[model samples]
Target: MSGQDTSEVGHGHGHGHGHGHSRSRTVAGLLSRVGHAIRPHSHDTADKTDQALEASSKGMRVLAVSFAALMATALVQSVIVAVSGSIALLGDTLHNFADALTALPLAIAFSLGRRAATRRFTYGYGRAEDLAGIVIVLLIAASAALAGYEAVVRLMHPQDVEALGWVAAAGVIGFLGNEAVARYRIKVGREIGSAALVADGLHARTDGFTSLAVLLGAGGAALGFPIADPIVGLAITAAICFVLRDAAREIYHRLMDAVDPRLVEQAESILSGVPGVKGVGSVRLRWIGHALRAEVDIQVSDRLSLVEAHAVAVAAEHRLIHDLPRLTAATVHADPDGSDGIDHHAVLATHR
Candidate 1:
């Protein structure tokens, strides 16, 4: 029999199995007696484009709302800073403003991600989100440097903080605004599987905590310790640095194409359960933007004709698409059990 090859792309749907299995005995079936264990995961693959578009829309809304909220929070704190001359409040306000502005790059990214794939960019514009994540990290670093610099300068030249009550109120406002934005961003980010959005949310959460530190400075200033304002400023800068570290690390992992190991195991289990599949081979999955694509290899009987093999391959691929979440495309290769006593991989063994 000649070798058969097949490729398919599917969005989540179930199809009747056309090919018959002759006393099927797959490697995966013998490995466990507990039966198939599938976790609860669902995907709206029927309308993939619509799903992607909706995710982008959600991201845009998050950016818009968060930007406006942070801007308003900063505006209120800026007025307090002018009247009270509190360096801690000033640092917190600047961070809030910077945090809000970071949304611009992410908005652009979401817009770019919505564009259809072209020959020059066959993978589409999903990686733009990771680039936006890089921009966010840089902005965070810049905010930290500025906050730290201002604190040192203020420490060298002590000054009394006026309107302590207003400064305290501004801190409360900042915390409330930032915490709300953080929760919303994180919730939507996980839903859409957008790492950049989640990182941005974490950045907002840190800003909220730092805003509360402004209250400590106001309390110290009220107690006759003028240096407390600058000290609090430095503390806020340290917190920003921590955020910078976490955001950078998350972006790095995404850029490196890191995924959960459980996803791979789950994919293998799904493929092995398919009828007519005798053995499972390499199963590879990767993210192209927010969605996932898979490549798999399966062993079939050498006695089967080329058409039967192709049908088996298609069946395996169909099973994969229906089971895996966010899996838009999959390539399944069917390898004969033992063809003419020849080793197909011997040609490439030397290279390895």
Candidate 2:
């Protein structure tokens, strides 16, 4: 028998085995039917799965590199500020150190996220990326709070800052380094659909902007306007707080499994286009890291046999997976037209 026939037999056997149905002749016939159903799209499905895996792997590698570079630059800045004795530089240095610390967890999360699903983790480690993003948000918030407090203290005490030129020079270096890394990460992250990498890129970009503020603050302090340093520090703190708030809101929505209405509509349109589907019942889509998990229900004729229904549902699943770029899995539950007394279309429409 051909590979297609073998795959069909395997699929039929899987379902039959679960139900403890022992009809050898019937199984053979069903397997042949499945083979016919699946043959046309087999190659396409395989290609899409391959592409998804490749893209995910490449994205993780880019994230690792970006995180490492950011950490190294942050460590150097921290050391420089410690020796220079400039409050604005010291604050910038501490912020960079915190950013460096966040990178370690991000690296681990990226590594875990790239692994295949196992018995212990049915969905793989994809959620690790999302969790890492949440941690980074919290870290940013903490950094902002610390900086704000320090800035306020400086404002009240009004201490003299030494080595303004050196501090400004370090800020310039940080600004350049951060801008380069941030732009690189952002470009790659969007291509691969990696939220964690994208968030880190934003963090790096923000750091670059804050570094400019630090430079200005130090320069102003040197020219005898000591208050400029404290004011700039306060501005940096406020920006960090704003970023943290937005990140937290996004994280909360994702964790709650909020479905994007547009994706649901897209899935519905795809499924409804299938030959045997009489109507689309419901469509649901959820994000699992950079990937999506989609579930759909369809209404078919009551006159159709169980085998026909199964075939149609399977075909729809295959089409949905192929059509949607980020979908990791697609499930279709078949329902007899108007049999369950639930208006599936109505439910889906309400959701949309």
Candidate 3:
């Protein structure tokens, strides 16, 4: 038999089996089972778990607050570095500016990502946040490159820096500010599962460490090792580059529709455990921002009627959605047992 002929026979047999199994569970029974399965967990709070909007709003608020704090520190740090003529402190100030730029996109993304699902876009705009994260990573990479170049130039021709005491004190203040912002954003991001916020938080925390390095470099320069200032700048640039590379990889996976393997296994286990399903044929999953879309094919008895087959498909879909909270949509295709016939070929041809 030709490849197409074999596929036709297989599809026909699967459809026949699906029809036979559909009658096992009525729509009402399936819905009741789904309800029971989907009941809220004991740890869920009435106020917090009820609304996506509330959760998204809180996430945006946290990010906005963190951005404001970073901006304030950046302005102070910039002024201090300019006065002290400290190359290390100036490099840290530029890092803060890049962070501030990233924050604007994050704020815009959070505000728009919460739009309700529409007819054309059933999943809304949640993925916009993920896109914003990608932008942040790119900006960090650019900043690192720029900083590295400047550090190399400074190293080639070292210059004396003044006002060492004031510059060090400003560095200390910047570090404290960045630390507080980073911790707050991280806490809120985890609570709301906001990737953009988490990325921003991590960026801020790194800035804090870089600020401390600048303070030390400024002190070293004052103590006669003038090259320490540019050397510290080079170190900070390397660290930022590492962070950018990691974030880019994560963003790439999400954008390319790579599903979490664990999630796929969990879904397969749930379907296989359903009472009447004899075998599973194929499963596919993809990510849509924070949510997942799943599709599955299953086999059932060939003697069942069309109505019976539909019921089985419904039951399977309900079970999948009920057990998997992250799944926003699912499609189930039913097949029949060993009744390979030419009619199945026609069905496949029509869809193709």
Candidate 4:
């Protein structure tokens, strides 16, 4: 029942059921406070960095493929726009082109993300993706503004939308290409946990719908309502604004280091289930680019020696790395219950 003997049992049955008495009490209040104030790095393995690299590669490939597809679609639509002079078709073409160009900033971000952590930038360049997201949001806003302007001008001076059949064909072509790109981007983005890519995919999805709007405009023009073309252009502009709002919100969340609350819940559950952990403390998770990192605190019996306590912490870390999706690194701290009357805070003072 003494400290040393109990510690041996604690370490050996680290996966055993929780100690009933200790289960109800929290043990890491000071540790949690200090840990948050002065975060310590417990794990940053090369394998995690390699995983990040693989994610970046996947992102780059998505961007390259989608960019080519959207560009080709826009080029075809531009040719039709020149012949038909349909304002709706013209607005759709511009948005497709802008969406394609957004890939450039993301490409740069992925490349930067691959670079190793340096003394100057210890967290590495993963935040570059968030910055690229900002670039994308601005581009969407710009496209919306330009499209709106053109639509208003066209409304004031309505022109005959020529070659109605060709304009209608271009709409179908735009929808097909943009929709295909959207599906691929969204699928891969979710797989990799890439908000930027997901946002871009949403942008592409809207582009597809606006392309369909072009078809409606064509129908209106054929019925002698030429104003329908400019009106559809305005509709497309409004869709772009919605996309802009969504994309900007995503980037803002990332910049603020917001993560899904469910991740924190999952981490807590995993730590609580660790055999030696008497209780779980704060579990924090954040996204750096497409990857995830976590910092957690756990309480073990005060009977456990430093080595046994460390073993518990290591077990918690391993569980997190194994169970969490996209989690690249995790830091776990083991706090001791104060039954032994040994002051752990005294140790922190020495380090300070």
Please provide TM-scores, in order, for all candidate models, with all chains considered together.
0.85, 0.80, 0.78, 0.84
Could you give candidate 1's per-residue lDDT for residues 1-352 as a string of tens digits? 0001112232112211223434454323322311221211123234555667788899999999999999999999999999999999999999998999999999998888888667677667888888888888888889899999999999999989999999999999999999999999999989987777887898898899999999999999999998999999999999998888998998888888877889999999998898778888888887766777787878877766555565566667767767887676677777777648977669989998
Mind sharing the TM-score for model 3? Answer: 0.78
- If both were scored by TM-score, which would come out higher, candidate 2 or candidate 4? 4
Q: Which candidate gets the maximum TM-score versus the true structure? A: 1
lDDT of 4 by residue, 1-352 (tens): 0001111112222222224445325244324423532332233344555566677889899999999999999999999999999989999999999999999999999888887667677666888998899899888888899999999999999999999999999999999999999999999898777888987888899899999999999999999899999999999999989888999899999999999898899889988887778888778887877878777867788765554466666567667777888776666767776566776669689687
Task: Give one digit per residue, the lDDT tens place, for model 2 in 1-352.
Answer: 0011112212120111111236685567558657766563566546645655666667657656666776777777777667765667666766776665666676667567667666677666777767877788778878888888888898998877777877788788778777887888788778866666677778778888888888888878878998888888888888777767777777787788776678888888888787667888668787777777766777776655677667767667777777866775666777767455766447589667
RMSD of 2: 7.3
Deviating ranges (above 4 Å) for candidate 1: 1-46, 339-341, 350-352
Off-target runs (Cα >4 Å) in candidate 3 are 1-50, 118-123, 337-352
Per residue, candidate 3 scores C-alpha lDDT tens digits across 28-123 of 554554453344222222222233456567876886787788889989988888887777787788888888788777777766666655656555
TM-score for candidate 4: 0.84
Judge candidate 3 at residue 189 and give its lDDT.
Answer: 74
Query: What is the Cα-based lDDT of residue 221 in candidate 2?
Result: 87
What Cα-based lDDT does every candidate model obtain? 0.79, 0.69, 0.70, 0.79
> For residue 241, what is the lDDT in candidate 1?
88
Error of 2 at 203 (Å): 2.3
Preferred candidate (lDDT higher): 3 or 4: 4
Root-mean-square deviation per candidate = 7.3, 7.3, 7.7, 8.7
